[model samples]
Target chain A: DTAVSQTPKYLVTQMGNDKSIKCEQNLGHDTMYWYKQDSKKFLKIMFSYNNKELIINETVPNRFSPKSPDKAHLNLHINSLELGDSAVYFCASKLRDGETQYFGPGTRLLVL
Target chain B: QQQVKQSPQSLIVQKGGISIINCAYENTAFDYFPWYQQFPGKGPALLIAIRPDVSEKKEGRFTISFNKSAKQFSLHIMDSQPGDSATYFCAASTLGGSEKLVFGKGMKLTVNP
Candidate 1:
């Protein structure tokens, strides 16, 4: 079984449009995270959730909001997506006490 | 500022050769260091990891060398094969609490056969 899974493998949207990406993990992890990989392949943390509690909120725009309904799911919703929002969004999860994070197949977002 | 910095953004090596990637971190609190390998269209996967307590950790052809005082670490791939070509990212995280991982700009490794 896929330990971590993400939906909408590819997203092509226009500016001012809103979109959402979904993530799910079956590894029974307690912490889930969202990372953004830019065109330069630089990966940076966006948001983190521990058992549905917001923990780390990086210097991301307010347009990007992460919602975790449960421990197994964390979804990202962007309001009025901009051109700079074009990048790969990855979902990762790991045990609360562990350091290893398993990543899901990234969702390629292209905001035109 | 980038907490963890990686060197040689890209490298090309011939098959059966050795490929080395280096990384440096500014945070002393970072106790967990890991290397993640990612293929095209795929998410990064954990390759190998080490802690400040150890200077070196080897698993098969992949090895990680860490220097706590200098806050430096490296990944060495022995007998690099074409199948091993991928982008490798060096990351560090301090355990406990949120444990947000800091990753360096990945290094793209191309192994030519």
Candidate 2:
């Protein structure tokens, strides 16, 4: 079984379109995170939820919102996406603070 | 500002040669450092990690050398193999804080047979 998984392995959308990516972790971790990897392969943390509570929110645009219905799932919703939104989105889960994080295969988003 | 800086954006090594990737962090508050390995079309996976208190750690052929005073660390892979070809990322985080990780620009390593 996969420790972490994300739906829509690939997403291709036009500009100004809205999209959502769902992530689920079977590792039974308490903390989940969303990271964006640009063309340069630089991974940056966008948001994090600890047991369904928002704990870390980066300086990302308002268009990006993360919702965690429960500790096992965290979803990212992008509103009015732009061309710069093209990147690979990865979901990660950690057992607790300062622990190794397991990552999902990632969802590739291409906004035209 | 990029908190963690990684060197050799790309690397090539022979099958039996040693491969090394270096990284430096400016955040003294960072207490945990981890290296992640990623293959094409795959998400980065935790390879090895080290804490500021530890100077070196080894797991199989992969080793992490940390210099807390210099705020720098490196990953050394011995007996490099083609199967080890992948992009490696260095990251840092502070425990009991936001717990958000700051990742470095990845280094792509190619082990040639």
Candidate 3:
């Protein structure tokens, strides 16, 4: 079974369009996170959730918002996407707050 | 500022040779350190990890060496094979509320047979 899974493996949208990516983890983890890998392959943290509680909120733009409905799911919504929003978004889960994180197959987002 | 800094953005090593990647962190509160390996078009997976209390930890052919005072750590891959070629990332996190991991720029390793 895939421990961490993300939907929309690839997303191609036009500028000013809004899109959402869904993520789910079956590892029974309590903490979930969203990370963005830029063109340079630099991974940066965007948001974090622990048992459905928002924790770390990085300097991501207001257009991007992370929503966690439950402990097993964390979804990312991008509003008015711009060309710079083109990158890979990854979903990860950890058994504990400060332990190892298991990542899902990233979703590549391309805003034209 | 990037909390965790990794060196030698890319590396090439012969098969059966040792591959080394280094990292450093500025946060004194960082208590946990982990290394992840990622292949093309795939997300990274944890290879091994070490805490500040221990200086070294080994699993299979991968080993982690940590220096608490200098806030430095490294991953050593013994007998690096062509299949071991991938991107490796180092991360550090401090325990508080929700431990958010800070990752460094990844290093791409190429093992030539």
Best by lDDT: 1
Candidate 3 residue pairs that clash: none
Chain B global fold similarity (TM-score) for predicted model 2 against the true chain B: 0.98
Off by over 4 Å in 1: none
| Lowest-sum lDDT 10-residue window in model 2 chain B | B94-103
Per-residue alpha-carbon lDDT of candidate 3 for residues B1-113, written as tens digits (9 for 90 to 100):
78999988999999999999999999998998999899999998999999899999999999999999899999999999999999999998886655777899999999999
For model 1, chain A alone compared with the true chain A gives a TM-score of 0.99
RMSD of each: 0.7, 0.8, 1.1
DockQ for all models: 0.92, 0.87, 0.78
Query: Candidate 3, DockQ to 2 decimals?
Result: 0.78
Best-matching candidate per DockQ: 1
What tens digits encode model 2's per-residue C-alpha lDDT throughout A1-112? 9889999999999999999999999988999999999998999999999999998989889999999999999999999999999999999999874478899999999998
Supply the global lDDT for candidate 1.
0.95
- lDDT for each residue of candidate 2 in B1-71, tens digit (9 for 90 to 100): 99999998999999999999999999999999999999999999999999888899999999999999899
* Candidate with the larger lDDT of 1 and 2: 1
lDDT of 1 at B16: 99
lDDT of 3 at B76: 97
